[model samples]
Target: MTLVNLATVLSKAKEGKYAVGAFNATDLNTARGIVEAAEQEKSPIILQFAESHSKYISLEQAANMYLDLATRACVPICVHLDHGENFNTIIRAIKLGFTSVMVDASLKPFEENIQNTKEIVKIAQSLGISVEAELGVMNAEDGSGSLDYNTMDDTYTSVQEAKEFVQKTKIDALAIAFGTVHGLYKKEPNLNYERIKAIQNCTDMPLVMHGGSGLSNEEYQQSVANGITKINYYSTMSFEVTNGLRNYLNSNSDAFLFDVDAKTIELVKNNIAEKIQIFGSSNKA
Candidate 1:
């Protein structure tokens, strides 16, 4: 059982100049894909469930399922709650044994975001769970995965405010909105490398890059080099699974419908393995 806290793995990534991939898993197959990628590449990975997806899988179920897989795996893994908006859900995740939780009150006012995050930090730190909080709102206001980068130009993370936010909240990681949107970009994204470096200098906490799915390999490397220690990935993997399953259904005979799930898992595993390498986490377990 190699289940460890997010701080342990993320701290190592910070020191090693790499980023750990945090994949959002909506079902057991997606979870297995993430874990398999980490195990195969010898990389530490995080499996998380967003608040919106909790309706499909309960906190207890996610914790139990991932804990089981993590304990038996050779690589280090952490179970985390992604975009944790509701306090009740955050409490439930912690009580259910999640090793990390993100308090995403970015949409709220600055003071309110701080107050809400501080509350969660107090509880999470007491139980040795790492807390990650977002400072700026991304382009994805709706639940839809994609976002318009232009609409988010005015909302990039403020370096000075980030220092204060971290100091007040005592979070383990900070997810900054540095020009990247949540879903696939319709046009090429102009990532603010300068802003990332500025924020990186403001705090020593492991920095995170949201919307990591659509960037080029060079962009990913640059982000990691500039101090991104954790990257949340999902949009591309979700597309891969959906596309794979759809193709399988269209081509395969009725007798082979039952095999679609297995095929989708295989496709997800392949995609994540590539992502782990892109994030420079391969062989870092």
Candidate 2:
């Protein structure tokens, strides 16, 4: 029964200098896997449902499942909404008991992004819910689609603008774009640790890293050392789960659907546990 808000866990991460893993849950088994990993590692975790994933599962269904899992978990778990584009959808998620919500207005003009995020922060903060907003646009868009690796430099977050955005919006966390994209990278990414340090110095609060998957272990540690306190990881975890299912199917051609589901849960749990260890959140609970 250690369900908590995003800021609560992030504050601890900021103090400990370890980034918490914010893993996206695509289904019930995936959600279960994330929590199980956290509990096993004794780490605090963020269980998030992305807006684009709505096509696979409704918001209400995900919210209900997340809340139930959080309440029954031993380690601290924050139920969050990832990349909530529409105002109504973000509000709806808050009302449905999400501990944290990310208002992604980065695609709009700077001033407009600030204004949009301010509106949500005003409401979410009052109810003791944490609000996270993105500062710069990612090359791969919101988690999936075309990836323009060539234009990645164009989306690097400006340190000055990041300071102003945090001051204006009063958000609990800031998701800054450096070199990471939302989905798989076409080539090895050249991350901007200096920019991460600069933003951390100015904001003096928790900083979030989107497109957290596909990076090397050293990259993750470097990002955390440079002041990334929350890392949004998904694509790689999803990929690993699919591969695990495929391998199981290959070995047992007559495997039942329930057997595959059980294997998915196990595979997902193992993958997330490995990530939790890599992020240096293990034993941080």
Candidate 3:
């Protein structure tokens, strides 16, 4: 009953001066952690399964799992397919009941990205599903090789183009690249606050900032103040989960290996709770 679509909640966040945390989860454990943390904090959360995760499971299976959890959850849960590339994948996600889908054709030519995203929006909005599209190029660091077409690694989202894209694509949210990458940053990347402000000024649509995991607290709050309504977080969650298990195994050795699952879940929950608070979504459900 608490399950909801991304647009409604994100729009609320836009007016409220807060940002919803979109956590990418690969398995039931991570999904549970995200939901539990959100419920405990009374924050609206987005549980997303990226297209890369489909390598191990089908879109139908992932969608059903998230839907089942969201239906029984205490707080709003938006099930999303993150960084979906093609029509077939997006169609599969929609058929499987994804509440939101990201059509990431940012690497393609501007006209092509617009056309592809527009096609998705046409279909998704008809089904009451919100669509998110990326405008700028971010280097693919996860070694997925899916973003090899992204030749403009240093390219940032054009403010003028962003206005036109929003007007043309009619997407619910726009993920703009403001100097952040996919994985962990080797150095502290400077976010273009001025660019973000410009884009926000030109468009009323909710803006999203990817590579949210490694940004400083000031950077996060600054993004929200400037008009970012949804922030995508993933690498930090994965890092915390793995680090928690590693520490647990090192301490437990032979006897308590099976208990690592609980510890991992706890770690993930704690990490998400902290992120929720940072995003200022806590108690905003």
Task: Report the C-alpha lDDT of model 1 over 188-242, residue by residue, as the tens digit.
Answer: 7889988888898988889999988878999999999999999999997897679
Best by TM-score: 2
Q: Per-model C-alpha lDDT, please?
A: 0.88, 0.92, 0.87
User: Model 3 over residues 56-123: C-alpha lDDT tens digits?
Assistant: 76788788788899989888889999999978999999998899999999989999999999999999
Per-residue alpha-carbon lDDT of candidate 2 for residues 1-285, written as tens digits (9 for 90 to 100): 578999999999999999999999878999998899999999999999999899999999999999999999998999999999999999999999999999999999999999999999999999999999999878774534456565577779999999999999999999999898877766778899998999999999799999998999999999999999999999988987898898889999989999988898899999999999999999998
Cα distance off (Å), candidate 1, residue 124: 1.0
Better of 1 and 3 by TM-score: 1
lDDT of 1 at 199: 90
Per-model C-alpha RMSD: 2.0, 1.9, 3.2
Q: What RMSD value applies to candidate 3?
A: 3.2
Best by lDDT: 2
Worst 10 residues of 2 by lDDT: 141-150
Model 3 alpha-carbon miss at residue 79, Å: 0.3
RMSD versus native structure for model 1: 2.0
